[model samples]
Target: MALEQLSALKYGKKTDLSAKLMNIHTKLRRYAAVHSGHANMQTTLCALAVDEDERAFAVNVGDSRMYRCRGGCIRQLSTDQSLVQMLYEQGRITADEKKTHAQKNVIFPVLGNASEEPQPCITEIIGGVQRGDIIIICSDGLSDYITQGEFEEILALPMRLPRRIAKLAEAAIKNGSPDNVSVVGVSMV
Candidate 1:
């Protein structure tokens, strides 16, 4: 349903990326309510879109994530909407505590939340990816097991994007990730 909503993006004149994501969010909420029948359907999303000029835009909800790596450094581009994240923000838990927290997987904002519609965190890159820059979009399954440093190490390696993604998935599994891992990687031309 979200995909259906987003498919219209390239049809018309270019629109503000954030506004387009907000429209998708609203559509997803409506779609969920109509189809779920009160069974509490939900799903997280993390996606990055890069324009012809390399300008980047991203939208995130729940525990899915987006990251950008450049020049041997990697940084998280989206904030998690999970309980542990809330605790961390409120000074109730240390940063390390979040990793081992009892409720690290509890996320409130998602693509399909009937109780409360999600508000996607929309981010715009002032000047997007350059040559050698890497953009990663992944589910919690991948993000939970991969470290920022590890992401930098793998993405910066002298390999193709597909190989880098394979290495990331392998690393996640090697690190004992118990959830499904999904990874998408983009490198500038």
Candidate 2:
């Protein structure tokens, strides 16, 4: 479904992509609910769309993330829709506390059996990408194990995209990630 959204974004208007994404979300929710008796179907998702004009659009649900790297600095573009994040936002916990919070892994909005509409975090990069900028999309398995400083350190390395992505996954495994790890990195030329 995400791939279809990306393909649509390539040829469709950026402003229209949000509605398309919402449609996809709705379908996923319905499918999950219908198949609940046959399969375990909850999931966190993060998607990125880069248009011909080089602008970037992101939609995320649950704890998956998207990040932007430029000038040796890495910044997270997608906020985790999890209980820990909400606690931090409400000033009930410190940033450091969030990392080890017991509810850190408790995601609030996931793609399954929804009683309410899914609220995906959507972001737009207005001027598009520039040379030397890097974009990364990954699941919580990778983000949960790697610190932001570690992400910066790895991303700053002068390596090809495939190697960098491999190294990111390797680091997560080495850090004892208990979930599936997926990472995709794109370097803007």
Candidate 3:
């Protein structure tokens, strides 16, 4: 199970909210244990401190990634815990082979492990969210079916948040997603 959290404060210092962030992340991980398939899943939490005062948080898990699109470039804030990733790191697999690997879908780590230290990997990004900054969280199902360019195109549309996310999910489903697909997009005002 993985715990996911999203929080923001406009006036207070972020250091004061560390405890709250930790608590929220703990809860999200507990929830994942109850719902996700892998009993020993490992989760990664990707968060960002939005605004100059660093007051926002975003949490995520599994292969569902959080992307930051800024300065005309996109960066992935989360890493996938899959065998394919391992192979890639070991130089046993190539970028092209990553997609068709026999263990591509296997999650290497997630939440609910029976280990002693049961902890979720957390990432915190500081600074404020700019007007044009884009935050996207989505399952691998969407990434697998759509090209990066296609995703950029879909996200670049002027549609509302719900509609845009729905469209992304629909696209993945139409492209034959064998697993559940989920996506969340946030743009700071």
Question: By TM-score, who's the top model here?
Answer: 2
Off by over 4 Å in 2: 1-14, 33-40, 51-54, 126-128
TM-score versus the correct structure, for each prediction: 0.83, 0.84, 0.68
lDDT string for model 1 (78-175, tens) is 88988999999999999999999998888986766666767777777656668877888898888889888888888877878899999999999999
lDDT of 2 at 125: 63
Per-prediction CA RMSD (Å): 2.9, 2.6, 4.9
Selected candidate, larger TM-score, 2 vs 3: 2
Ranking by TM-score: 2, 1, 3
Models ranked on lDDT? 1, 2, 3
Segments in model 3 whose C-alpha atoms lie over 4 Å from true places? 1-52, 55-61, 71-73, 115-119, 124-128
State model 1's lDDT.
0.79
Query: Candidate 3 — number of clashing residue pairs?
Result: 14
Residues 1-189 of candidate 2 have per-residue lDDT tens digits of: 445544555443435655665676676766666775634455667876666666677778778898888888887888889899999999999999988898788887565436555577777765456788888989888988998788888887787788888998999999999989999888888
Query: Candidate 2, after superposition: displacement of residue 124 in Å?
Result: 2.6
